[model samples]
Target: MTPQTQPAPAPSPTQATAGTRRGRRPSLGAVALYPATFLALLVVAWFAVTTTGLVQPYIIPSPVDTWKAFTDNPEYLWGHTLVTTGETLAGFVIAAVVGVLVAVLMVYSPTLEKTFYPLILFAQVIPKIAIAPLFVVWLGFGASPKVLVAVLMAFFPVVISGISGLRSVDPELLELTSTMGASRIKTFWKVRFPAALPELLSGLKVAATLAVTGAVVGEFVGANSGLGFVILQANGNIDTAMLFAALIIMSALGVLLFAIIQVAETLLIPWHASRRNRG
Candidate 1:
């Protein structure tokens, strides 16, 4: 009878090293192939429909025509993009600061939590769009209103996540810290806060997306500048291509900001379970 044998072991060290190096090197052609294919398909489909006279030119501009619009007045769109991005970043920072502090306080002091928790929940249910006009009236057609609106929209997620994180300390860990004669503040800083980090980061990601929406809403209400204002102006004049371009830019900005946050989270919490899974 032939001798039974186990499967070969994973490659020895030198071969494994070579395999990893090949995999790690970024491939430009591979990255570009699929997106270019899809883009070509989209253009062909759009041209076919528009050229067939099935739709009016103004109702659905061809890809070539949209390109012309984008190239012709890029400066105008870029200026408004800057304004929207600035407001989003500002409001996001404020929300992060205040949300963390409030959540921490709530976690530590039941009285403080009970006092404002109901009011905070009530405020969250109020319609954001309805408050848009009020923000414009109170803060006027400036950056303040846009920033505040963004802050309001993004703050809740951070607060909600932070509370859950701060309070999720294991009872066993708490008892261990107590047996070691650690003070409450010391135990919190050394043990509790670190445990909560993964949840807080997940919440931050949600807040980042909402923050962009808030800035746009703020612009829609009364601003003379910004992506939202640009959309309104473009719609009034029926400049659909520019409107779409502005929206695309806003989407890119949001994605970039959120990506940065995710990268930071990965770096700061490498030992956390989610980060390990991501790796």
Candidate 2:
């Protein structure tokens, strides 16, 4: 008998598409390299501008001075950073729970949607800055106010995206699920919720970053602690370097939280188009 050879499996759609673009598209490392190089150049320009006295030190502190600010007083900055992080995490968690619950209620009940959806939109339009003080008054000058402010800032996006996601389920699929004798709760959990994960996660990622801003805003308005307070104090004292350091820390915190959400999205829904595209 003649020896037989097994044929190779056909490439998948993703593989074929990737192959087609391999020559045209920049490699992942190249894409990353460009950003890294750009950032390095930016830092070099910043250092040059400050060191060469192109900008006044009081106006734009040198990067070395900014580094010194953190090194000289690590305890002060680190403590405030931890406090801000805690408030942000607390507010984000609360917003996620409330937003998802509200989305589910609106999706399931037309009455609730008709009555409450407009109200929710109205609430979003009301400036959180105008209301941040009220929370401080009602909840006292504590973490409560900061957390509430963060919640207000982050809540709407999650609710809106979640509602869209849940409602995006194909009506035909829902009908089929009903015909198959699945209960409403079962259908939602098994089909609708999963279908909505991508949009919901996108909203959460936005909310996560907003939560940081909200926390800082609350601290700016009232709190005596946190990076926001540090910035405020630095401004009053003309400590531009310290102010820059605080700002840098806040930006890093937001980036860290957003990155965490991205990781969670990948882990939770590896099959999502966004995750697959990244791959």
Output the number of the TM-score-best candidate: 2
lDDT of 2 by residue, 1-279 (tens): 855577766778787666442245456587579879998998999999999999999999998999999999999999999999999999999999999999999988999999999999998999888888888889887898999999988999999999999988889999899789988889989999999999999999999999999999888889889888999999999999999999999999998999899779867876677666653
Q: What's the number of clashes in each of the models?
A: 0, 0
Off by over 4 Å in 1: 1-53
Using all chains and alpha carbons, the TM-scores for the candidates as numbered come to 0.82, 0.89
lDDT tens per residue, model 1, 104-201: 99998899999989977877788787898998889889999999989999899999999999888798999898899978889988998898888899
Clashing pairs in 1: none
Model 2 spans with C-alpha error above 4 angstroms: 1-31
Candidate 2 local Cα displacement, residue 38, angstroms: 1.7
Q: Estimate the lDDT of model 2.
A: 0.90
TM-score of 1: 0.82
Provide the global lDDT of candidate 1 against the true structure: 0.85
Q: Each candidate's lDDT (Cα)?
A: 0.85, 0.90
